[model samples]
Target chain A: MSKSSFVAEAVKKYGQDRESLMPILQYVYEKKHYLSKEDMQEVAEALDLSSADVYGTASFYSFLDTKEKGEKIIRVCKSISCDLKNKEQIISAIESKLNIKNGQTTPDKKFTLLETNCLGWCHKGPAMLINDNVYTELTPEKAVAAIEENL
Target chain B: MSTDKLQKFKKRIDLIFSDVNWKEILDKALKTSADDIIKELIASCIRGRGGAGFPTGLKWKFAAQQKSDKKYVICNADEGEPGTFKDREILDKQAKKVFLGMAICAHTVGSDEGYIYLRGEYKFLVPQLEKELEEFHKELKAKKLDFKISIRLGSGAYVCGEETALIESMEGRRGEPRNKPPFPVVSGYLGKPTVVNNVETFVYTAMILKDGSKQFCELGTKDSRGSKVFSVSGDTPNPGIYELELGMTLDEFVELFGDGDTKAVQVGGASGFCVPRRKFKETIIGFEGIPTGGSMMLFNSSRSMYNVLHNFLDFFCEESCGQCTPCRVGCQQLLKGIVAVKAKEKPSKYLEDLKGMTETMKSSSKCGLGQSVPNCFNSIIDNFKEEVIY
Candidate 1:
């Protein structure tokens, strides 16, 4: 299946209405891991919306990355609760294991590291999301092990 | 049920986490008339659990009265407040209740469609929730009801928790708030009459419909009726969720949940008030005092109020939609102002100007996100001035 056809399938799964723009973008992003210029343009054309409008909506959400992302995106919780629990240590553990800093993608394109505000798991802080899977109550060892599982 | 010491403190209730017969609940609520359901909700006095504390009954009633061909019921599962996380628990434990609550509202308001806007962070729970939604639809169909509920995932943006902004995001637009007056109850969701409620609030409605309004009303104080779920975290042995009876004084709350060395408790979330040690006895934890959306973050003596306040300001700066000037600019300036104050570059007097700007944002900002910033800002600065200044 070609890229444009995948988007066409998503447009069919959800309607072509204005409301379908978000689901369509999400579907496309899930397959490609990010929305490139052409993917967003195709979504805009399919939904009969401006490319800028599609771009604006995608940019508004932290999960709807408009830029490039690797096969797996790791979002470490940086909110106050997670911060107090030493999220820096958790990030460092992943950073050393993956050989990439925060907001950077690995050379192999298998992992991307980023920090996010509150994943709603404050009680079990030091949490991170690898793609849609959530790992919580992470010690440095546990965080590294979770990343290693993906590897 | 109150003892000498316990009377001075909070009263814990077991209704929220207690067991329920969903089959019976569905049978009773579905058979009840729409008017009676709204009336019982009014009598129950249950308010929105999303921190805004709007009357849940009045919202359903207003949406019901609106004359539109299409109506909507939205369960706001976008739980992104800094310290709050009870909605996720509620959905995890009693998802059917949330769906049934939407079904009840749809029947009352004469609507056939509903949506649950779950946050992107909670995407892991999607499979189970979707599975339950299918079962819920089957139950509704067995009763021959016309209501249908679907789940929508919200890409992480805290401002989308606001109702109009949630509606806008549902329409595939930016999650920025719309101007008020024509609230979501009147003009919403494809420009139709709609009812948008917090995830926990919907659960409460389902419970209320089961046990009758009088039982729920009798639980809490006059001003705040029924129990509330509190997302308790930070500086405590017990750092999880609890459903306690409302009207507890802060002193009682601190006594129950605070660590031995606790210096303050940030009631609600970052957008909530900061109660220092001195004011705990006088502060109430309900609508009569400082109402919370159920975020109670305790801080021990070792932690710095400056750091806490800075964390919140940094969060606001990153999350602000940048549509409104007061929130977009005011958040950055406040964060910068504090750094300058702490470094002694700006005089201690400059904090007052920042306070003035918060007041301005409170009055002029487009939505609740900007308006409520003053709650944490003022309370933290006023209570922890020495920590903030030098």
Candidate 2:
């Protein structure tokens, strides 16, 4: 389906009320991996909201990235629990494996690695979120293996 | 120091994680009058398990008293605190109880609509939660209850865990908090009379009804009643969730969860207090000494206190919704202050100036995130002054 139609479909599915804006934005964000200008404009027009307002709300959330993103987004948990568990090692491993640094998307547009605050998997530290899936208790080997599956 | 105190330390309870026949509890709650249910809740002495320690019964009663037809009950599943993951565990394991608890509140507060503002990081659990909600709606229909629950997603904003911000996010806006005076119980979620509670708080409300008020009230101390679910992590041997009765001293907690070389415990999360080993004997893990939203992270001698402090400040710097000046500026300045002081850019006495800034933030900041930054800041700096300075 066309991206504009996808946004229109999200608005229809979630309803045109003010309450449905987050779901609609999330629907588009997940499908497109990020919200573009046209996508936000399409959503705003469908919801009868201003494009700036739509962008404002989208930009407020970390998950609703305004930047261009890859097919998969890896958000590593960087909070203290994960840090103590050597989260840095996990980041280094993924960076070398993908040949990209943290906060940079791979050249092939397959993965974007970023650091996020506590993923609420404190007990199982060194956790990461790839798209929607959660990978916890990560070693360098485990993180690479998990990323390899997505490839 | 004393065996008598040590013996009373770790009383592991199973009210939260245990499998419950939720229908029996719902039938009992549904049959009882709302006033009577409120009375039982009050008598049970269960406070909001979401760290604030507000009386849960009073919150329900206030919403019940509101003369609005469209009262809403929200389950705050935005579990964003650093070491706090018990809410996720509860929702993952006993979501049925959480749904029923919301239904109980809905019936009590005279509302038909409910929402669970789950964090976006936990999107992985959405499928499981949706499955539970379907079963819940079916159960509600079978019982002929005039209530329905919907799940709303929070897009990676920690401040949304604050009830007003949660309400704002639900209304499809920025998650920055609003001023108090019209708390969520009175005016929340599209300006309706709303009751917002933590995942564990709702489960306890249901569990309170299930076990009767007397059973819950008998468990803990006067100030903090009933057991709380804690997300224990860091240097602990058993790093996971555990439900224990409130009012245990820090010494007792460390004995059970701490490594022998434990240096300090970061009670609560980034926004919670830090307790060193010297004061562990006197520090009670409840409202008396320090209140928490169930995040207990241990630190051993191997770790540097400076790094921990830096991480928390960095978190606050990012998570502080930039709407307010004190939080936005204060967080950035505090982070810079620590880095400069460590690098000898400023004298060590400059730490005192930074301490003054936290006091300013504690008073002037708009929300709990900024206000509570001083909790760990003051505690960690004061106790680990050498580590922070050197």
Candidate 3:
């Protein structure tokens, strides 16, 4: 339940190197769903580093954040290629179906909707990333099914 | 999509790359006058399809004028930005065109060697491209040509997309941007003169050589000439690649996307300027009197401006390459301020700090990443101030 125990589970895979904190943080953030503040404190304490140090490394990247963890993070591709392909309908459908507007977490914290720029999959437009998995050629119906599967 | 227009366009392409033999294409293009090529290019007024809308011919002339025995022409295929994917499309679909284009640029610039710098994740695209290159190389070798080229894969670092950073990575260093002033046009790659261009830019060279600059210039606006390939994504129908003339307003573009059902469009990529719904019609994609070949569109109401911007800023914060104070430290501080504002945690205290830092980022920083990273912040604050300000 605490950050150290969470990290204790990770020590074997990540090793005890404080320098590995960023990589470890990335892994844990991906696994645990989000980088919790308490987890940041735990990482700092476990690595014998200051919380500011841990926070600095965590906050440095766009992928990691200290915000309250969401059940799902939807990064929709809004870059030019995807834009040409109609990413808007997918965003609106997903938002309406999820009952949460863009950038908002559901009341149950089942999802956090965010519109991400290009995931580099231009040929397949209207794409979204559910957690780390990329779902390409997405439609409004398909988006709902994908979220439901996660839920 | 009228048949006449489409037929005319296809006819133009067929007429251009008519000769299948690489040598024939090269010989025909080479014998064509550079002045004529420049003329056609200016007429087309095609903007550099790369992120920057710099005029392609002007850029070539600058590098061509600088007398250097070791000048290099680099094709930037390191497409790493999140929403952008047009470069890869060209590289994957019309690879022969890409190579043939590069060859023309090399010939025009009088460079003997060229390199195609691609992003690492493009693992699938590289091998296929390499095979095509081999065929082209073999044909050139058979023809007894002096020109040579090689491919360098970028290791998943967004910062390397910067010309200077790209030069560093090609030289086998960590992919971080270096100080400029001695731009790549002067000192680059192996400390030799280099002209780094987007994949589309080189591709256009083939067109210019084939068509003549004057003809090419005639396609787009008088100032911003040539056709632009926009990666249209987001809300609307037919979200795919659209090749349009320069000076096409965003409203016209959105209408092409299907109906008027749209919210915002993120022109350029992560480092590009964002035009809100209100200003979409007024903005025209172009360079210094030209259009950049790289136009990415982000659409739809499903996306919130706040989240899109936060994600962009966060990407900049992580990928600053840490080479300078403004970009390295300033990005982090700005991210913190964004988070604080979003959470409504001491919002006023961080707003001015964010503003001051953005001004510094724009004023200082070594390259485009540091300087333009602030644009993400500025656009969001100006366009989506209500969404961001708690």
- lDDT tens per residue, model 3, A42-90: 8777777788877765664445656875867877866545555567898
Query: A41 in model 3: Cα distance from truth in Å?
Result: 33
Q: What TM-score would every model get versus the actual structure?
A: 0.97, 0.97, 0.71
* Rank by DockQ (best first): 2, 1, 3
On the 0 to 100 scale, the lDDT of residue B204 in model 1 is 92
* Candidates 1 and 3 compared by DockQ, better number: 1
- DockQ list for all candidates: 0.85, 0.90, 0.13
Docking quality band of candidate 2, CAPRI definitions: high
Model 1 CA deviation exceeding 4 Å by range: A1-3, B1-12
Tens-place lDDT digits, model 2, residues B1-390? 333443354344679888989988889899999999899999998999999889999999999999986889999999999999998889899999999899999999999999999999988889999999998899899999989998899999999999898888888898989999799888998899999999999999999999898989888789888899989999987788888889989988888888788999999899999999999999999988798999999999999999999999999989998999988999999889889889989888998999998889999988898899999889998999888888
Higher-lDDT candidate of 2 and 3: 2
- lDDT (Cα, tens digit) per residue for candidate 1, span A108-132: 8889999998899889887889999
Across B74-103, the per-residue lDDT of candidate 1 in tens digits comes to 999999998889999989988988888898
Model 2 chain A scores worst on lDDT over the 10 consecutive residues at A1-10
Best by lDDT: 2
Candidate 1 A-chain TM-score: 0.96
Error of 2 at A15 (Å): 1.3
| Residue A151, model 2, lDDT | 98
